[model samples]
Target: MKIKVINKGHHALPEYQTELSAGLDLRAVLSESKVLAPLERVLVPTGLYIELPQGYEAQVRPRSGLAFKHGLSVLNAPGTIDADYRGEIGVLLVNLSNEQFEVKDGERVAQLVIAKHETVEWEPVETLSDTERGAGGYGSTGKK
Candidate 1:
């Protein structure tokens, strides 16, 4: 799938790190370093704009290494970018550790995964079919 994008930052466009990667890394577009104190959250811009086709969305997610190493993660995990939005891509980053973290210009902070979705139509019904589990959730099945 092809997407139209505009990059105003100094770094190259977001791309997958490997051949089989599902997400593309997004970088911070800051002129200087920005500090995030412990438990602080901020919106970090990527200076990237994209036009996605209908029935598709761009999901912004956190990098695993950053989360495990620095306790930094996307405040809204898997943040959704609608197909109609045409604004700069910003990531909501939060510091979960007890120390401050510095975000530098063009630093890889988050990732973008383009996904295809479906919209469901409402169907009025009197009753629904039942299952053995039947709406059981949140550890309903005992762990072995």
Candidate 2:
């Protein structure tokens, strides 16, 4: 599936893995080299914006290697990108380690997974069937 990408900044193009074992790679577009201090958050923007296919959504996730080594992660674990949105894909990354983290241009910042969505509909009902534990609060089964 070939998606159209519009590069809004002077940065490297976003690359996609041709094989199934890999995820769509997003690159970095930085105006100047900077470091993210411990527990500091930074907004990393992708040079390219895209239009995903209808009925499908793009899930923005953190890179496993970066998270494991640098203690960095996405603020929102899995950010959702609607198919209709045509803005630059911005990722909010937080540095959990007690060190300054530098993000260089063309570095893989995140990965995108294309997935389908199910439409939901709501209907008004007069009465509903009861379950084993009707309207039970948290831990209704009992705590040991």
Candidate 3:
């Protein structure tokens, strides 16, 4: 499933670390290091533009190492990139720690996962079928 991509910066293309890895590491393409204060968020560009096939979408997710070590995370975890979008990829990052975090050029910031999605059609019905846990909201099930 090779997709078309355009690299507009000097950084290497995003790649999976292992053979079975589902996501590719995305890097930040910054001119200079940007300091992010606690609770601050910024949009970091990747200088990558991709063309995904129809019914497939790209999801921008956080790197677990960055999130657990530096308290940095993708603001919109699993940010969706539609198949029709042709703009550069940007990662929305937020600092959740007390200390300021610096975003350096070509630093791995996020992970991108290509996913297949289904298009739903309107199946209007008078009422939905009922089950034992029908209409149950969040946490309706026991914690155990």
Candidate 4:
């Protein structure tokens, strides 16, 4: 439940008031920004470090405000933070907006959620069991 931040930024670390907070918080590095087209994706850096407890993982997710307002989002939605990754946390952000997005320093870029996971051994199965519609994807259950 404790995260370590490396550098001091223009803004404070983003915290969660609820039980599920994806990322602690981070600042944006926008001086050398990339130009993107409408709906294009760019890698946005989140300058933060993390120290997660064992058996828990951090998921890099997009902030709802950014997504709804400017179509900005995390490129690798739900990016994973491995338990052993003792490195600075960076977010891979993308501009899903039509126009070029200017992300200033200390912007609330994304959210981080701490989750519990299990390390499992892979066991091969001979045959898979069938269901009503097994492995049917992409709106197999008619669009609403």
lDDT per residue as tens, model 1, 49-93: 999999999999999999999999999999999999999999999
Worst 10 residues of 4 by lDDT: 1-10
Give per-candidate clash totals.
0, 0, 0, 7
lDDT against true structure, model 2: 0.82
Candidate 3 per-residue lDDT over residues 93-127, each given as its tens digit:
99999999999998999999999999999998999
**Predictions: Cα RMSD each:** 1.3, 3.0, 1.2, 3.3
What TM-score fits each model?
0.96, 0.80, 0.97, 0.76
**Clashing pairs in model 3, backbone N/Cα/C closer than 3 A:** none
Give the better candidate number (1 or 4) by TM-score.
1
Task: Assess each prediction's global lDDT (C-alpha) against the native.
Answer: 0.96, 0.82, 0.96, 0.73
How big is the positional error of residue 64 in model 4, measured in Å on the Cα after superposition? 1.3
Q: Ten residues in a row with the worst lDDT in model 3?
A: 135-144
- Which regions of candidate 2 fall more than 4 Å away from where they truly are? 9-12, 126-144
